[model samples]
Target: MSVRRWWWVAALGLAVTGCRTTGSAARDGQGTPPKQELQFDPVTVTADLELDKLNDEELFAGGTSAFAANDFKQAARYFGRLADFHPDSRHRRAALYNAGLSHQRLKEWEEAEHRFSELADPEKGQGDALDAAFRVAESRYHLERYDEAVKLLGTIAAREDLPVNRRLEAQVQQGVCQLEAGRGEEAEKTLRKSLATYEALADKDEVDDYFPAQAHFFVGEIYRLHYEGVKLDPAKGSDKLAEDLNYKAELLLSAQGHYLRSIRVGNGYWATAAGAQIGALYENLYEHMVNSPAPAELNAEEAQVYRQELRKKIRVLITKSINIYERTLETAERIGSQSAFVDRTRASLEKMKALLLADAEGEPAPDPAAADGEPHS
Candidate 1:
């Protein structure tokens, strides 16, 4: 559920950059077109001609220029004009695609979906229709229309004509869509199948493994979140608590297996994410045990004994978590990577070190009310 809430933050946690083709007139959509001025329709067009005065080709060129300059708002408007107002223009398909991509860059999901859906329409689509269809799924995912995204992704994944990587991406996105839809079990099965497909691919090494890496990391999250749901009842005493903890541990190790799989691929971002989550698993366990309700059967003197002894046993969790955070941070540095996960690992590492130091110094637990920013009573 935690993953579902923010999984769309980076296109399944990928700060991925894709290719952009500006137009025939411009240099690869980089800076301003140095040589190509807008050749307006046989009139004395001024240097700063308005959008209304520009011809369709000129609009296309302007959109490309705007897109290259990271002015996606202008790019969307110009490209939308080329696609909508100039139906007869030769650059119509390119214009629509550019418009959709521009909208996506701006996080305008509905507008992006509309543009892509038009190009992906059976009657309207051309050679790039498959790509447009994929973008439509992405737009739908961003819009939180997980069911629609899953359906569209299924169709994309089933296509034999597309590249293996494209199909794999579709399948992976489909699984994630299912997860976002609150279908965890189905999502895990779909993700496992996707991983199997990736493993079976002969050209797997030649292509990007981002999707598969995500598959591993998300499966780990699935288990981790499930583990978070396991509750303890102190009334059940130590033996029953041990059983509950065992189940929780099994879920964590299951998650840990997937996290290990994610790191094994060496895709820098996903690996960092998995590593951070792995540390959090132990940290969470420590917190959970320490914060559980005290056993009702214990006398006041016995309760103090229980708390101290419990802290002594669970202290290893902090140590283990600290080790993982340190290692993960080192791995992120070695890979020359930066992400929220790396920041989290660094912070968690510091926090755990503080906890370990506090315990070592025999500092009393801070009062609960004073945990707020107010001075202790």
Candidate 2:
């Protein structure tokens, strides 16, 4: 069978034996509703293929045991059977939850998405629905359905019922999705909001120290990615886009500052990663600035001023990039030697510096006497 078809068949099998098999019966209406009670049947499907003596708790325990043993496929099977056969059992919802988690562990993305999506349906199982929603969004993200993931995460972000950390995580994921979808402006905005929220929560001692830095790192990545994309684009006409590009560049600068601050406050992989990203952004901006054409409207004085400012920015960025490269190289050397990737990056940085230096020398000066003799406007 085709991959998609096989995926669907597996998903169908899981659904038939999982949450989708639950009965649609409502309790009878009375003056007062009947006291809710969990129901279970004792019939175990054993290795001999005989349903002999299994209780709901036993079945659930078996599934949990399988999960703990890293037999996610077996765990899913057991959990699916329980969910399918014991619809009214208290373990039914939990069974479905376990099934979803197991599928996720198995990397059965479509199957996991189906189960999580079902659990997240408001009209269906209300047990940990918010968690399910988040997982569904995560699954979609992994599947590269970035727009769908963003939409789902956006909803989660807007909900007040979610915990601060969960809400912040959703917001960050939404920003990630937006970035993947090429909505850089939206991603930057969302990531900024997430970072601010994380910071506020951290200040109140509501969250761990790591979350805030993670938020900042993601925000930094958004700006860095945005700058890279704009710098790569060949078209140059709109003042608005140029302004946006400049704004993104400034954001990267600010992000680099934040990354350094994070390192000062707390040492972690995030700070190191952020430092590398900042270096890459600087290289990208340096290359763009070096290649940028001179504006037509500038007089000699205006041109000189513009060139001076540009040179200052480029020089600062180039120096920063070189510093970061040295640090990365040291880390790589300690880690057992540089990879081809790092070698290529180092070469690129060197080329970028050469270009920047060439650009910094400015245009060749016409002979002052000849120009003065001939030029009177």
For every model shown, the clashing-pair count is 0, 1
Worst 10 residues of 1 by lDDT: 3-12
TM-scores of the models, in the order given: 0.79, 0.56
lDDT of 1 by residue, 285-367 (tens): 98898789777877899989988878865776777787778889999999898999999899999999898888878855443
lDDT of each: 0.77, 0.63
Model 1 regions lying over 4 Å from their true place: 1-49, 121-127, 363-377
Best by lDDT: 1
Residue 139 in model 1: lDDT: 90
Q: Assess candidate 1 and give its lDDT.
A: 0.77
Inter-residue clash pairs, candidate 1: none
- Candidate with top TM-score is 1
